[model samples]
Target chain A: MFMFNSLVENNLKIISKLKKSLARPDLGAITGTILVFLFFILVARDTGMFSLEGTMNWGIVSSQFIIIAVGACLLMIAGEFDLSVGSMIGFAGIVIAVTSVVWGWPIWLSIIIAFILSMLLGALIGFIVIKTNLPSFIVSLAFLYILRGLTIFGSIHSTQKTIIGGINEVSKGDWLAPLFGGKIFTGLFTWFAEQGWIDVFEFGTRAGQPIVDGIPMMIVWAVVLVIFAHFLLNYTRFGNWIFASGGDAKAARYVGVPVDKIKILMFVFTAFCATVFATCQVIEFGSASADRGVLKEFEAIISVVIGGALLTGGYGSVIGATFGAIIFGVVQQGLFFIGVESSLFRVFLGIILLLSVIFNAHIRKIIIGKG
Target chain B: METPIMQLTDIGKHFCSIKALSNVSIKIIQGECHCLLGDNGAGKSTFIKIMSGVHQPTSGQIYFSGEMTTIESPRSAIDSGIATVYQDLAMIPLMSVMRNFWLGRELVKNIGPFKIMDTKKCNAILMQEMEKMGISLHDPSQSVGTLSGGEKQSVAIARAVYFGAKVLILDEPTSALGVYQTEKVLKTIAKVREKGIAVVFISHNVNHALEVGDKFTVLCRGKTLGTAVRGKIDYAQLQYMMSGEKLN
Candidate 1:
């Protein structure tokens, strides 16, 4: 009888511990990320998806996604939506290109002006949403269309076509271009090449060139943003307010938290991040098209949701969203490297999003029941 | 009277032509649980809102710590050491107990240029305050939704006391709680009173109020019926007064 009692007690303890761990919102996202990464690494081994060069290719793409996803994750945790982010990216890129190329403005000055204008528009959206108390989904959805239309109109007005080019040429002599968009760690890569640590084509015109030359600026920006956001969400009082405002605005307000202010700041931050991504991409690609960044807002929201942030708001981790972006980057690049149809990528995204929602809901139910 | 901590005199409120509260007066003394009893629509909510600075009374005078003061906003009221624990307790259920304990006025330590929340200090203070309320939580990091309804109330009360509130207003704290939870909340209120803070307890249940209140003020139809000390008025008289009747 004593043995039976001990066994039951031990089982109860184990169950309680598991419940405690699962109660954390990030657990689902972490599990999803691991499973996806392992699946890709296993299936695409022959495609060199695990190679340094392959990693670099996906890393660059994922970093761009992470920049906006981190901001969207924060905003979601504050209980708002920013469907305008994708359109804002396109709009910001056009603004940067038009000012620098069409108007002969300095690239650095155009970048600054574009960022400030995007932030102002973001603040306006936040103010209107707060004042009107309308659902943010509806508010941002309207902005999505408005900004996209404006981008197209502005591009036609400036370049006469949907595409605007020569931004790379325009930024040739600019001092900030190298810092914002070019490669870094070239010296380290060169040392690695000298030591024969990097892969090289055995017998081709590109035989002497190392496959992994240097780390791109995009990856660096993404890493910096991840670290910065993690600290902001976990260590700051503003972070607490974000959770509080998203969790229960009414309750937060009663406790003297500036719920409205936190939410407005979140909206503005999301816009600023969209601009950051636009700036980086414009510098790297040397042009902007009105159609660029199409449907990116949905991708960002999906990344945030997969990162364990609830659609209803009030629980998420920047680290988890970073993993979510990694998952997206892996799948996107893995398919191309493995000779799968590129269009099938969207199908994978849809499935992952659906599965994440179901898994998160199941985990929440268990935690709530046990709690 | 040792100078009542807060005094509301002839407080009146009107919503257009509708009178929500009128000529309501109450004096709250330190170390006392002054029960403000009223039936539904008896102006209890309006009176508390006015006291908490949610609304401005059309005609009234408020005295705080022996001086005339105007509570222009909820933030100002909190700054002036007035804390209100609403029916919902104003707590985020998903947040940890420690986080909820220091939601608005979180303690921060500056590291470099970043002002980060001092989780260590928040956790320690939360545990200490909760223990003083005669409730021992196994883990301060546990989400508050896991706590019993009575425990949530205790956390709210303990948070208010920890913040050095001179006047704590509780709005129907036990209305949704079970009988056992209600008992626990009443005990917490007594403990808070022992700390020498004036408590404004709003409730309709005279029995619950009598269990912890030192004095009682009954409101009916936007008017103050009367006030009585614990020993002076029995439960029968309090119930009758609450039911819109008066004794000769």
Candidate 2:
């Protein structure tokens, strides 16, 4: 009987420890990521989905989500939302195309201008929200329309058609384009192929070349953004001000925190992320299109929510958002690999989003329950 | 005679057509807990706002350290070493106690071009300060939401004191606390006084006010009823003034 009592006490201690760790904001995101990976590994084992090539394919897709998810997570934590992110993407892409292809400007100059313009627009959005005291939701939503409208107007005014091609042609040999469009570590991959470590092409002019030559800049940006965002939120004074601003603006002000400035900066960051995404897409597709980023704002928000960020603000995790982006990439590519109709991806998104929201609400209750 | 740390003379505030406060004057001295007693809607909030620079008085002059000064904004008010801990306490519930303690003025260490928050040093300082102030805090990472009402107030008071608040204005610090917690906060007030920091303890609780208050100022309907030192005016008279009843 004494032995049984000790065992029970040990179990209770472990349970208490588990409960303490469970209070993390991204508990749901971490669990969901594990479940997703396990499911995909079981079902898509024979489909080459875990192969280097396949991994890179889904990784690229996930990288796109992670880039924007980082920005959205920060903004949400700071108690604001940027609905104009999608439109900003389309608008930025057009700016690049119009500047480089149409106006004969250098690719580097085009990219710089795109960033500058988008950030200014973002500042305007933030300024209006603060001055008018309107909800960020309404202000950004209005910008969503204005930016998209301006994008279409610019496209029709310059290129005379919706799509503008030749970025791949014009961007070649440009020093700056490669940072967004090109890849890195080809020499390492070649060594791996020579050592019979990776698959290599065996026919024609491309014979003996490694199939997976290098990591794309897009994926590199995503990884860098995740690391930077994680460090900023966890190890920076600005991060504390972010939590303060969202937690209680008036209280933060009383304590001398500049809530308005931090909020406006968050908005600018969202635009900066959107521009980064636009540049990557234009490089990858070798073209610009008016309808490029439709509904992307919702996707970024969903990824953040799935990562366990509270929509109400003042609590979130960058790692959680990264996993959420990975979930998007894996599930999306997994469905296609298993011979399932890709359209079911939308259905999966809806269900997962609902589950995540429910899970996040439960987490919020537990956090508050401690009080 | 020692000069008061802060003085407000003939302060009046009008919100459009309504007069929130009129001809209100008060003096806060060094190392004294001055209680501001008033019933609801007696211009208590407006009075504090004017002093804290949240709202400028339509007619008034503010003298700080015996020098006439204009506090144009909350930032300037904080710069002048005047901190107000309102009922909300200005704390983020989701943040750790240390983080909330240093919310705005975060301790940062330089890394090349970047400034990173020094979490280790912040935790150490928070523990040291909490211990020094006699507020028993076990973990610096414990969320403020998990703390009891009195503990949260103590955190706010401690934060104000640590940030070098010469004049600390607390709005109903004990109203939401239980009797035991209220006593704890009163003890904290005494601790602040020992350090020579002037305190403005605003409350409607006459008994609580009588316990810690060295001087009492009464406000009734946007006007000053009277001001009295603690020993000179007994509890019954202060209670009557708190009820907004004027003594002729």
Model 2, range B1-248, lDDT digits (tens) per residue?
78999999999999998999999999999999999999889999899888888899999899999999888987888888999888875577877899899888899999999999998999998998898788999678877877788888988999989999999999999999899999999999999999999999999888999999999999989999879998998888987887778855
Q: Estimate each model's TM-score.
A: 0.97, 0.96
- What residue pairs are clashing in model 1? none
DockQ of 1: 0.67
Tens-digit lDDT track for model 1 on A7-94?
9999998987888888777777778778878888789988888889888988888898899998899999999999999999999999
Q: Show where candidate 2 strays beyond 4 Å.
A: A1-16
Reference-based lDDT, residue A232, model 1 = 86
Candidate 2 lDDT, A174-289, residue by residue in tens: 99999999889989999999999999998989999999999999999999999999988989988888888877787887877889999999999999999999999999899998
TM-score of each model's chain B: 0.97, 0.97
Q: Which candidate is the best by lDDT?
A: 2
